[model samples]
Structures are given as structure tokens and as C-alpha cells.
Target: MTNDQRDPADRPRSWPYAAAAYVFAVVMVGTTLPTPLYGLYQEEIGFSSLMVTVIFAVYAAGVIAVLMVAGGVSDVLGRRPVLLAGLGCAAASALCFLFEGGLPLLFAGRVLSGFSAGLFTGTATVAVMELAPRHRRGRASFAATAANMLGLGCGPLLAGLLAQYAPWPLRLPYLVHLGLAAVATCLTLVLPETVRHAGPRPALRPRRPSVPAGTRSVFIPAALAAFAGFAMFGLFTSVAPSFMAQTLGVHNLAVSGLVVFLTFAASTVGQASLGGVPAERALPLGCFVLVAGLAAIGGSLLATSLALLVAGAVVAGVGQGLLFRAGLSAVSARAPADRRGETTSAFFVVAYLGISLPVVGVGALSLALGLRDAGLVFSACAMVLAGSIGIWLLRAVPRRPRPGA
Candidate 1:
């Protein structure tokens, strides 16, 4: 039989694809396991709310630093080595959290977690998508995105349960995560390496944030929408629990974790919906929906209503998920094969910036204006930013041309 017409069983198995997806999911979950536990840390360590934001920002800072220096290293060094290294970093981060007693260790743990996630974000997604069966690429894309959101959502939920119901609430969660990291590391070693390179590994060079020239025009508006969408996510994950407890009188950790999970779960749904829509169209629609969700969140903060907050979280989560997938598909489609890894990394750099910078602003505002008012201000600002970007994307992005037209 011709190569193209060979039996399906003759093709490489797809279990490795699923395994990579699971490993990346585990890594993403570890990054956010500390979310619900932040409250515990504040109480145990005797730090102010502002300090929580500072510590969270340290994670973002570490992610950006790594994205700049080593984001594209996997392209040259191969996906497995980078992924294994990232898992190692994650294991180290978990150990730091297990031993954490003060602000310094918290900062160090988050930075290490950020470093680990920065490594995994680009490499894992590419690995999964590349390994997918030709006919199942669309499903694979959703799987990759679902794994990300599911992992993130599970982190807080798992931590909250263990923290609230188990012995050694603060310590147990990290130990559990440490165990997962060990398993993930072993899985990484067994997975087949995707990148084929015959020469010695390239010397580590300083990473610079960049995308392919062909993708730049489309990348700009997509990145902007992602930035705003991820900022809303960052706020929810990092500070929303504090708002719920302090401003709304909801102090239950499980409930708080559920609230955060709902948002990310909605994002998975949103990303899945994009399978039926074109990326060019999905980009603007997702941004507009995201803006509306932000407005709802601001309204919820003003009214001090739990229902409103939950509704806003769901709406914003869906929008963020849709836009994130759109951005990923568009960039990946336009990028040249040789530079695909770097291009994907550049997109995530913008996405992570959204996760970091705006949340830090909210933290600063909380210090000056109080939590509820600060949330209102943060939501309003994000709405305005999202709305502006939506308009730009709608006007600037061209309709998708017919294949081979």
C-alpha cells in the first residue's frame, strides 16, 4: 500500500498524545494549587492582603522571565528534555511549598512554579497537537485546551477539599501535588520524543519574545484580546476568594474553590464551542462576550451579590476560553513549521502578561481603595480594554480565505 493509504494501526499510536496532555494538565494544576491556600498562608504567616498579591505577582514575574529566556529552547533542545526539566522544576516548587514557613519561601515556591509552567505551556500543547491523528486534530486542539482549564480548575478544588477536610490542611495539598509531579516525571520519560535532531543540543541562549513575520498582523489583535481575557482569569484565580470571604461574608474554602472552578470549567466549554466556528470570527465574538462578563463582574462587586459574581465568572470564563483557542489556532495555522514552537511561545507570553500585570494592578488598588471597590475598578478597566480590542479585531482581521484560493 502507498504510505498515505496505509492501515490506521500502522500509524503511530495516539496514547502518547493523551499521556502528554495529562502530564501538561498536571503541571498546569500545580501552578494554581496555591490559590485557595493563599488565605491559609496569610493567616498562618501574618501577612497583609497586599502581600498576597505581591507573592502571586512573583509567580507571574518568574513565568515572564522564563518565557523570555527559555521559551523557545524546546524548539532546539527537543520537547522531551524541556518537558522533563519543567516537571523537575515543578517537583522542586512543590517541595518548597511543603517546607514553606514564611513569605520568602512562598515567593520562591511561586517563582519556581511559574518557571515550570512557562516551560510546559508551549511545549506540551505543540506535542499534543502534533501527535494527534490527522483526522482528529480538531479534537486534539480541544483536548489540549480542556486539559489546561481542567488542570487549573482542579488545582484549587483539590487543594480546597484537602485543606478544609483533611489533616494538616496547609501541608497535605503540596504533598499530594508532589506525588503527582513524581508520576508526571516518569510519564515524561516514557513518552516518545517528537522533535528529531541529530546534532548536539544547542547552547542555551537568551530567549526573546517573538512570532513569525507572516503571523504578526493577525497575532497583534489576537494577543490583545488574550491579554484582557487572561487578566480577568488571573483576577479570579488570585484574588476572588479574598473578595468572597472579606466582602461577601463567604468564608468556606470549598465554596470558594467551586466558584473559581466554575469559571475555568466555563472556559473549557467556550473553547470547545470554537470547533463549530472559524478562528477569525471567534476572536472578535469572544472579546465582546468577555467585555460583557467583565461588566457583570463589576456590577456584582457593587451589589455584593454572590449570584451575580457566579454569573459573571461563568460568562467571563467562557469568553476567555473561546478567545484563547481562537488565538492559538490562528497563530499556529499561520506559523511556519520551523518556527512553530517559538510562535506559540510568543502567544503565551502575551497571554501570561495578561495573567500577571493586571492582577498586580488590582492588588495595588485594593491597598488604596479597599477590596470591593478595587474589584469594581479592576473589572471596569478590563471591560474597557476588552471592548477596545474587540473592535480592533473585528475591523483588522480579514475573513478566512478559501483553501488554495
Candidate 2:
């Protein structure tokens, strides 16, 4: 049978879907394991906090580079192959970290990890959605987001605990991840392929961030909202640990990781709360909540209050989670089916840009000013962006007609 005419029986099963989700989760966890370890690396390598942010930025750079070039390769080549390739990169990243003896090696390891995540982000989401049981697409979206958030949250938590209590702090965590990568690779091999393609493997091309025609109007507000939300996420992922250490006099890595994890876990909660809410309504509401969260975070930074910081993280994470799901669902729902993958990739490119660029700016600013001052600035800017988007979304997205009104 032709590619389009393949039997339905050959499609992926529920077990494979679950397996893929687990693999994606593992990869995400590995990427952020270094969060709690940055302080350790600082003592070992003698780099400044700015240098640490630079190192973190390198990872984001690697991810964007791969996304631009290979983001859509899975659409043509098949999800399993791309996923395996990602796992291979992830395994290599772990190995790089395991033996990292210097700053350059750290950069190299992080870059590889970023590339691995770049490959997985879009492919994994598509894989989970495609493999989900027909009746559970909504639930599957939650599962995918939850997996991403939980894995990210767990990374630091696991690393912090290990670093605090384990025999070999740096070496052991990556070694454990290497083992997980091996398992994920095996899972990828067994999972059924989803893409039905007949043409020869396409030559790799540069990945450009482009909105589909007619989507530009809606895409701008959505992308801006995403940028704002993810910028907040980037702050937590990249610098919040140091903030806890330097500003609040908190030196416990486990506690630091827990704070970061709470933000992401709360995001998972926010996303889950959208069961009955329409995407349009959720979009603006999410933005408003995000602004409040940003305000709280800024206040926490100014006051050096851990309670305020944690509260802000939880609130902002929820807003981000809600907006992300709503925005993605809206765009994906509107895109043409054939171009869905590309469009989705485009949306994420914007999201990840939000994750990287603004955080880099924060890093650069931290060099001139202090960390707390810089964080306050970053939080203020992000809040403004989110608030603007919320207002636009409110005006642009039509209110859903009430049932039997």
C-alpha cells in the first residue's frame, strides 16, 4: 500500500505512547540537572555568576540552532528516527558532563544537551498527540505538558539531593542520566513510527521562525504573550538558584531546586485547570494571571522575601501554563493539517526565543547592576509584555457565545 493508504493496524499503540512520554520526560530531566550544580561548578571553576548565565545561554543557543535546522526533519523522516537521534545527543551530553574537566567542556556538554532538547521538543509533542487514544487528546496534551514540567522540575530536585548526599556529586548524576538515555533509546527503537512519508529523506535546511499567512494577526499577540511567559520561566531555570543563594542567603541546593520545581509544577496545575475553558477565553485570563505573577516575583526580589518569590513563581507558572496550552491549541487548531507541523514548530521557535533571549539580556544586565536589581528589571519588563498581550488578547479574541444564551 502507498504511504497514505497504510493500514490503521500498523499505527502506534497506547503503550508506545506512554513509553515515548516517559522518554521525553527523561530527556527534559537531564537537561536541567545542572541547575542545582551551578554553584558547585562555580566553586570548582571560579567563574562569575555572569559566566554561569553565559554558560546557560550557550545551551539555549544550541537548541535554537538545531530547531532552525532540523526542527521539521521529523515531519519528513519519521518521529522515531528523530527521537532516537535526540536520545543519542542526550546520551553524549551526559557523557560530556560526566568527564567535564573545564569550562569549555561544560559549554560543550550544555550545547549538546540543548541540541538534544531542540530535537525532542516538537517531535515529542507530536508523537504523544498522535499516539494518544482518540478520546484522550485533551488529556494527552496535559500529559505532555505535565511530563515536560515534571521532568524539568525533577531534574534539579534529583541533582540537588544527589549532590548533597551522594558519593560523587557531579559525576553520579550524569552517569545515572546516561543509564536513562540507554533505556530511552531502546524505547524509541520499539515505538511505532507515526509520519507516513514516501519521498527520500530530505536534505537538512535552516530553520526559520515564520508565521503562516493570515496567522500573523493572531500570531503576534500569541507569540508576545508566550515570549513574556517563557521569559519568566527562563528566569527560574537559569538564575533563580543564584538569586536564592546570593540574595536570600539560601545556600541549600535542594531548597533552590524545590523553589524552581514549584514554579513548573504550578504551571502543570494551571494547564490542567483548563479542562472546560475554551482557548480564546483562557488566553487573556492566563496573560492577566501571568502579569500578577511577574509582579509578585519582582516584589519578592526587591524585598528579598522567599515567601513572595515562591508565591510569584507559583502564580506565574500557572499563568504561563494556561497561556501556553491555550495559545498552542489555538494556533494548531487554526493551521492547515498538512502544514501543522511547521506551524507548530514556528510557534515553539517563538516560545523558546522567549525562553532564551530575554534571559540573556538579564544576564548581560546583571553584569552592570546587581543580581537582585537585574531581576527586578527583568520581572518588570516581562510583566509589561504580558499585560500588553493580555489586553490585546482580550480585545482580539471573541468571547465565546454562552450556551443557550
lDDT of all the models against the reference?
Answer: 0.84, 0.84
Of candidate 1, the 10-residue stretch with the lowest lDDT total is 1-10
Off by over 4 Å in 2: 1-13, 135-138, 198-209, 399-405
Candidate 1, lDDT over the whole model: 0.84
How well does candidate 1 score on lDDT at residue 136? 70
Backbone clashes, each candidate: 1, 1
Q: What lDDT tens digits, residue by residue, belong to model 2 across residues 58-95? A: 88888878877777788667888899988988888888
lDDT of 1 by residue, 175-287 (tens): 99988888888888997766664566556677577887778988888888899988988898899889999888888888888888899999999988887688888988999
Off by over 4 Å in 1: 1-12, 133-135, 198-204, 212-214, 397-405
Per-model TM-score versus the true fold: 0.92, 0.93
